[model samples]
Target chain A: MMQKSTIRVLLAGAAIATVLAGCGARDKAPAAQPQVAPSVAHSSGNAGSSAEPQAPQSKPQAPQPKTASVHTYFGDENGTGLVVKQTTITYASDSDKYGAALKALQHPGDSKAVSLFDGFTFKSVKLESGKLYLDLKLDDQARTGSEAEELTLQALQKTLFQFPEVAEIYVTVDGAKVDSLMGHMDLPYPIKRSQ
Target chain B: MKRLWVGAGLLLGMLALPQVAMAAGGATTQLFLNGKPLAAEVPPRIISGNTLVPVRIIAENLGAKVGWDDRTKQVTVTSGATKLVLTIDKPEVAVGDKTEQLEVAPTIVEGNTMLPVRFVAEKLGLKVTWDELTRSVFLYKKSSGTAAADSGANGGTSGAGGSAAAGAGAAGSTGANAGAGTAGGTAAGGASAGVAHAAEPDPDSKPGIVQAIDFTGDRLTIKTNGVTTKPNLFHLSGPERLVLDVPYAVLDEALKAKLNGTVGEIAVQHPLAQKIRFSNYSSDPPTARIIIDLKGRAELVPVEAKQLQPGQFAYDLKLAKYLVVIDAGHGGKDSGAISVTGKMEKTFNLAMATKVSELLRKEPLIEVQMTRSDDTFVELDDRVAFANTRNADLFLSIHGNKYTASSTGTETYYYRDESLDFAKTIHKHLVPATGFADRGVRQEPFRVVKGTTMPGILVEVGYLSNKNDEKKMFDEAFQNQVAASLVAGIKDYLNIQ
Candidate 1:
């Protein structure tokens, strides 16, 4: 029994080390000011899946471009530790879908739900083999610990995975693939969507 | 500004590396496999706070022949019942027919295939024993081992009453393990998940009383009503602390009253020490938990008291060497200040900071840890947290300054009054060594310095923005000179010649 407990702790430490190994800082960090809007810097050679038409509402009209709001998770103030919250994020166009999802993570629906990207910016985002890759540059204000690290990754993963097109999310801090998210949780590359 | 530095880049990995730092370190841990003491080729290092040993030593001792594949970077070990395949920097291990997700990956450190000891031991049906005081990992095969069963025995006694380690007539003291009357009165399930376990403690074991707490000389002792069982003791660095959990002891009326007047959410101080908090943290076999918030890195002395009084026994602890935290200013995403010669201030800060560590490490008495060892982004808050948790004796943040062309010299900064002496000591040697105009030492409310509890100094080696100062700061010879001078200043402050 004691050995099992000891193993759990070791696993936790290993989970954390993997994240720390992949975490990197930018050479030139900008100030802590939050970036304005998601830029058109988001690029995609293939955004073919999320282009399906929306089901007609009430009466048949021109096949309206499908739009959806992203759902994200954050630590809650009540009995349960985490609660999933929705934001006014819309993914209607294929070219701008990734940026919209990332924007939701950068600025959460609730102020209480922290923005993981508040002090960071992304150089680019890519999708291949059904996985979305994010190359981010973290700034000085970005907190590093079990809580901040895990919550930030969950917020990003849960939000981006909302799109049927994105089945897994692989995060690279400043362009390096990571083994864990923020040094504790196991970050299996192409982080799969969590229920 | 005098506080300028180049941005520290957080290095990503190849197999795309993410972050650089894993966890903190402590006194070296010794590894012992089976009944005989085993030695690791690389001496087993603490990575991210977990003690990892060379795979070959333990695998061979467990009767396994190991083979390493250079192309695949995989380690395959074949034992009697186990055939294991592990990859470097990957999180999964395949044991026989079962695939298990690994918490930590096996890595090649300095060309040695190092794997986490606990992971290896448990997978092979061996028990891993951790000795906190000596920092030892004792591995004993499960069939003949009694340690696991001994620890589990407490669970049987917890439900009936209080700590019954000795399992005698005093077992009727109202179960502290069942969320009943214990030390802090938070019920039995109040064992915090932070420093210790969250599971229920044994309630039926022979309950022992915590008669007294003794603090004298260089050691602190805990006195109990009977022979204390294997109470676990270990120290954690961040916010430096010590934890002692006596799983078979209950808070009797005498000790409960003392704890009642004390042991709250707010910690009470001991004159010689910081604070000692107590609780009846478990109920299974009944347990008593004590937490000590320390002021520095503490080393436990091997000598424990045989007897304090007629019925009381004592456990002794001691403190160790002075801890020093070194901070390299300006890292990734935050470019502190660009140099007049187009060099990044972050570059010089890291260079000099590492040099200082290289020189200081030669001294046996001083323990040095850098907030960063490479071009990685570490938050300013975390930098202080690293020092604060370690309860460092001194903190030195090294950086080259940036200012108008007219502003060209060395200066030192301090936030608290206690830090003034440190600033003056470093500046006295640094200015002359740099051959720049002396701006002297002054007080400033810098985040890194202001937040840390220990005396801290932020030294501006030279102006990165000034032409002459920039030229000097950029030179490798000058950088080494500055590093040596900083070490000298530290030695002087520590009263070393």
Candidate 2:
């Protein structure tokens, strides 16, 4: 009686082991097929247009992006200094209104400044470490002063400092430091924001 | 009584002979007196300024007859009884019963009443003689018997005798009128008559006397005895000019003393082909006739001096040469040009000009006129005008040039007109002597050039733009050279050498 019962139990154990193996194989096969097909579709599409191919290819690398930073100097209307947070400001390349006001202060009674800043527009504003950095692109109209210093100061300080994020503003004109516009004064150093 | 009558007859005969002698011998006497060679005739007689001739003689010779008048210095003459009555110094004559006024008066002298010889003689059909040299009176009466005899002798040639006699008489009258009438009339008339008439006297009068006037053409010549007197007084119109002419004149001490305050100076030159000229300058037409208070007699040869050329009637003032004015142009605010180094043109011009003036001042012959000694803008016109006002001899304007760094040289510019030669002469030496690049002389339209009456020119020194030129322009040694050259040129132009 004991020999017959032990043989039946061994058979039952063998059948259960077979069923679990089959189920595991099926799951593995479906998963492998789906992954392979999508990769193939991607490769074909890349082959059709090489220029857009890098977009998808780069997606995996998107999380590790590159950052560019530039430093500039600025002064106030009276060439004074001031401070504020970097987050509150917006910067522009050509902001003629701001430039005109600064030029007005420089010339004091010059009427030509009104027409000289007519079409100028501003481009971008940036801040790093509490200092406001203004990126400006001045049109021909905005370039005044014997050397355009007054116009640079006007646009940079007035426009950028309007934002609360801007604290101490700095400006760079065409990537250089010029002595003065039209020989009115010495613009040897960066102009400070007027308080 | 018989002896008395013989003596009276002798006396009467002497008087009658003298009259005949005067008619004949007086011809030669008048010839020498008239300042002309003997031409022909019966000389014209001037009685109380009226020319006259013997009525009976002229009329009878002219184939006319004489009639007696008992009233009013009258004598009647008739040709075929066409009678005319003439009186002394009267413009009236009676032609038969009708009275006619003559254009001029008849004249009487020394118991001889004379009438218009040509008029009365021709009217009376007589032949008259005119001695141009003697200016004496004569008549050739044509008798009927003489005419008949001449016709018989010469076969109807008697007509020739009559016409020839008339022509000869006319010729004689013309000659006579030129002499005695001319000389006697002018001498008696005096200077006042010539002035009143504004007419030229006849050319046949004595050398030292006034002559008969030619009312047709106004020309006058007066000769006076040797006596140094003031110029004869005369009046003129139209920018009224006064003229004075003297022969053998010398400025005496008294005259010189008077001239000091009254007359500016005297200039001398030959005014005419044979006349020496004297030009006098005074504030006005000499209020006091130029009283040539003389030590000796000076001859007066009054000539009507007229400019044959078109210009101011220059009175040649025979004066000693001494005075001269030198002028410099541009000053003050009119800083002509600014150098690259910021030196003002005006400053340098004035500085250099002043130096030149100082140099000239050292010379006794020169009188310098600085248009502006300081920094002040003088108008271009003012520069030359001032020189003219001062009667300057030479006007020189100093200027410096400014141009791009390329322009480098010294140039002198003059107004290309006749009046500015003195300026041009100075400029000739200016560029060469200063050791600057001689750009040569040029003609320009500048105010100083045009406005000056005197000779004027403008000098442009070395360029202020060129570094080399500027250095030379600023150098004192160069300036001295310029000044010296300018002075030398002035002296040379004036013939001071």
Candidate 3:
């Protein structure tokens, strides 16, 4: 599991990897310490420490995402509608994050979390013609309205765009291009990652 | 003074002809281009105030190959520069980079595909004219818009200023929050308020028509028909051309005569202020785009002044300056997040944004502008527009986080991959100063970052939902400290002293 509790420490080390390189690089900085700051996360953690960042205990291995974490921007009923929450979703293989992310979207674990794909059924997600075709089945085609449908599409589009391998998103209801979700909001316009 | 007055009179004479030529009374319209008659098989007719013609008739002659998918009910028209996609009975048409709503959908006529003539022509770069008296519709591509259209090919509303379109919006704060304009934004839901989706159809919708265009003293003001419109204005370098897009506006053939759409080449000489070009970027909620190519001694000034009218805007060109626009997250009816202390997160955001701007201004040659200098509500789209039109080098949006009083930390977000380094560079310095848990720099599709063409970041400084975090954040002195820290971080990221 790629826990923020762990990766943060290593990320902090990478941020200060210059510190461990023995001050030989920059001639005029503070004398370099060859240690990694595993406790760097805590420096900001309610510690209220005003001191400069210290060096971390040395580690030989390179910093990389050995354990993957899924960052989900779930709609928060309390605050700004959406608050990002992380899940320790590491795959057995490196290529498994896509499946895991979809699973995470199905259930991201929040009491106030609103379902973006509620009326729509998840039929399948396929890569066709350089675009990701997300085929869905509608539960109630007649009554979808402005508020819920737009939010759902926003959630779905944002979530799918996270995976760069999936170039664009084309949503279909019961294997057909939809005009709108409930009545007003339109759908399946080949959603691309916003530049 | 003499040149400015001369250009203004010429602009009046140039633009006045189109409005006079398009006086409405047409049942059936004939096609004409550059004084030449255009013959069509099906003939063009008006439906519900919009003109519709055979897709093949207009599509084929405009140097386009038309294709149809009968099973899918889709019509795809491919041209050299633009691809037009429309579905039968569907009110939406996909133009390049935007999905525009058609006032009337396409239908099959006899054996041919029929679509909105104004929409198809405007989207395909063909200018349209409807003479009510003659009942004639003219369609043709100008041989002169090369310099203007060529400028359109190079992307971005900033870096080099370009076109902009403004659609009048309803007074729905949270209602239009549902107006999802977040192009590739990762921020999930509309937590803030007063974000009205301008393009949504309503009876209150105003027509976007260009009234008058005046080029005086290096500034160009493209006035609209009735009410004023917020125009997207830009100017390109290397020949210095001004481009303006009036959203929800339409054009008649008279305006086409003024343009020189010889794609990709700038005209250096013309009898009327270098060369002039115009294109209808969109028709559903129609947008009228005008580009003026400037010649020797022509330079655009950075200041943009909105006239006394509701939508009259005048701007000169300003290029290659390192200007930073700091946006305070939410305001007024857009309460943003309600803190645990019952304080609005918008309060904190504005405070932080103000401080950052104040501190950054202290730096030499660094320009700083706040999206909202006070507590006035600025919509999501407008916030990006302010940064873009201002030609900011970097943009920073400030907001406080909200959750179940437990999720606490400082997290910085970016939309594009290029902004990651900018986000990280700021987070590296900003997070440590907050004395909050570092959530790390992450990439999320956010409007402030995604909607902008420059390096932009949205900083969630701390969680107001958390009591401890709120305590530190609520401190006015603490906000000033965070603001100063943010400024230092920006300086670090920008590599300025």
lDDT of 2 by residue, A107-185 (tens): 2122212222332343434456556544444543333211123334444454445434446755544553332221122
Give model 2's TM-score versus the native structure: 0.30
The superposed Cα distance between candidate 1 and the true structure at residue B26, in angstroms, equals 29
Candidate 2 chain B: 10-residue stretch with minimal lDDT: B1-10
DockQ of each model against the real complex?
0.02, 0.01, 0.03
Could you give the CAPRI-style class of model 3?
A: incorrect
Q: What is the interface RMSD of each candidate, in Å?
A: 14.5, 18.6, 11.4
Winner of 2 and 3 under TM-score: 3
* Residue range B6-117, candidate 1, lDDT tens digits: 0111000000110001111234565543222353435567677577887756555654678888658799877666788999999799988889987778886533678887
Worst 10 residues of 1 chain B by lDDT: B11-20
Candidates, ranked, TM-score: 1, 3, 2
Query: What lDDT, from 0 to 1, does candidate 2 have?
Result: 0.41
Candidate 1: give the TM-score of chain A: 0.54
lDDT of 3 by residue, B1-497 (tens): 00000111111222222222332222336454322233343455577978777664555455567888856789888876788789998998888668989999997543346788778877766556565555556553533334255445433213211111111121111112222121211111111111111221221356556656666655555656554345544433344455554644655455545434411222333333575555554332345656666553233443444434555666553332368999998676456666777787778888888888888778765888998988887756567767664546788988887554576788888878878888988898887789888877866555567777678888888877689999999898888778888888888887776
Using DockQ as the yardstick, the better of models 2 and 3 is 3
Per-candidate clashes, comma-separated: 62, 76, 37
For residue B228, what is the lDDT in candidate 3? 30
lDDT of 1 at B34: 29
